[model samples]
Target: MAGQQVYLDHNATGPMHPEVVAAVLPYIQGGFGNPSAPYAIGQENHRAVDRAREQVAGLVGATAGDVVFTGGGTEANNLAISGAFLGRSEPMRRHLVLSAIEHPSVRETCAWLEAVHGAEVTVVGVGCDGRVRLDELAAALRPDTLLVTVMHANNETGVLQPVAEIGQLLRDRGVRFHVDGVQAAGRIPVDVAAIGCQSYSLSAHKFGGLKGTGALILRDPSGVMPILQGGHQERGWRAGTENVPGIVSMGAAADVARRDLSANMAHGLALRVIFDNLSARIPQCWRNGHAGLRLPNTTSLCCYHADAMSVVLALSSVGISVGTGSACASHSQEPSHVLLAMGLDEQAAFCTIRISTGPENTVEEARWAADQIAQAVERVRLVTAPEDIGGCGEDCPCFAHSSR
Candidate 1:
């Protein structure tokens, strides 16, 4: 295992669990019949899809029939946001409410609604801790607001929003609510009934399943129309031929997550504890997001005067991997919108990095990664130190004291 990398970026995506891969192998190899066909083999495949539906439903306290499989979390979010507006005929009820810290999938979908459909969008900002300001949300709500879409957990900072409270606020008002639970589903305990969201999105790959598979759990599918139309699959809620192997793996992953939820959470928290302890000793290392209300696996650190990209590259060279921000938006030169909305200045946002751990990570790995990160930060500082700051070399006590 020499030079093997330690992966600490689970929020971006996760490796498939052993059980999930085993469950999907047979379907990938030989279960090639179309679920829509009437032949015996097709019928067997149809049953497999049904069983998957139930397994996914069980993860969120939903019924099998309420789950509509989609391409991934992005599609599920788009369908939930757009389909809600398209299904209704009222031009007056065109306003949509969303959190500023939402994933790009939800944020961009709302932007599309505003640009193409002439709908009004109300974006409520988050506080310094990265939790949505509930008061601002309440003030932004109007009678014409069609639906409120909030993510259960933020992707970059892993801040857990007050989704259950938001749901309760909108529940009696007859307005629909959607929770993009892509990051929250397998990492934390999620109950669709308990959260009381009308629609919830989940990505299979996020919870140790294969990519290219996801589902939208709905309370009532009658209220939402299909985003893609042509085939009659997913009871017409979603169209196209099913991904049999991916669907099977998603189910297997969900089953494993359901059984290991508590243990997995504990494992993640252990990693975070190590990170927090190490971060305390690193100069100018400020932790972002809510301390107690954040995900157990995620720790967002902002190192003043140290470039985030440099830290990422330095770690990569040392056989450790982390993220600067959301992998989906990493291609952009712009700093994270989530961090900016949380009141971080442009420079601080640029200096931020996210470390999200998975269940397989060991304590030794965590400690080693922490030490390497500290060294990398020191190396970057030494290389970039200004000439005016004399004697601020790697061993300078004055520089270290000032950084504190």
Candidate 2:
């Protein structure tokens, strides 16, 4: 392994920005007063938290009063789905709509609702390009549908959904909409008003802030009920004492991300160009998402005949970090559900890996990482038996060639 590591898994988590770290250090060290207390020190912390709310709101084009801080993105998503459902009346809350490629947080929460609360779930499928089929989504909606939740960008394939259009459709139908913006918030321009979603969720760690902190932006705070009932924190939307330091860090990160959004996007595009050029040289290796309709920083590549796990391990041995899918489900031995929904078979899905870049990643690092990936895939393919080389069956060119 090399002494210097090249990180390409920004979708899972990004390194904290120096400014964010500096911003949070004071809160961690001496700004320890509880925001709920009546003392002067407590008032100061409360003011700081309020400022952070505005900063986070600015990143998503939302009002400060609409932002509700939570423990993390998972909790934010849980609050968005479960809280909205629980707040609704009987028949209205009976049905829910979701995309096929949502993060496990949204998927599992809906599953729980179906099992426990008897909510009917309609999971709309995606096209081969990993984009949700709008017609299918429209068809899935019913009078009993309470809410439709979809992610702005897929965590595994990075494909951007037709959120604005979906929002318009839901608006015309008088149905509520929620968007999981965890992977899209810092990477792209996000206007909640433009999206027309009633609620949106984002995580700090996916950008350049500390982990264990996130926020849910609500267009109408009264539309959803609180899952955690205790303090009057977050305007009665969420309970428990505030995470002052983490919230401060998120504010700092959001400010920087908004300021450098264009520059960061350009940097990501440059890295992707390098990766695409190099990876194109590898045999039977293809991108998994829409070529132009995905996040600038994310690349999902499938190297046929190379086991994704083996490739990931080989790249790790060389100090290049990547991921097979969402970090939340990394421990699962199952193939990527995102790819499968996009029409990839299990074997093709198992041979896929994700590379998501960040502002800190340089063009030189991207070149080195792409080269390492190609070499790693080659190494894995060399060891794979002919029988295991083709997942496309008898008509597959690779399968026919290997048989001879």
Q: Pick the candidate with the highest lDDT.
A: 2
lDDT (10s digit) by residue, model 2, range 165-275: 999899877688999999999899999999999999999999999999999998865557899988899888878999999898889999999999999998999998777
Scored by lDDT, model 1 comes in at 0.88
Which residue window of length 10 is worst by lDDT in model 1?
385-394
Query: RMSDs, each prediction?
Result: 6.5, 5.8
Tell me the spans in candidate 1 whose CA falls farther than 4 Å from its real position: 385-404
Report every candidate's CA lDDT: 0.88, 0.89
| Cα lDDT of model 1 by residue, 284-317, tens digit | 8889999989889999998877777778889998
Which stretches in model 2 have alpha-carbon errors above 4 Å? 90-92, 386-404
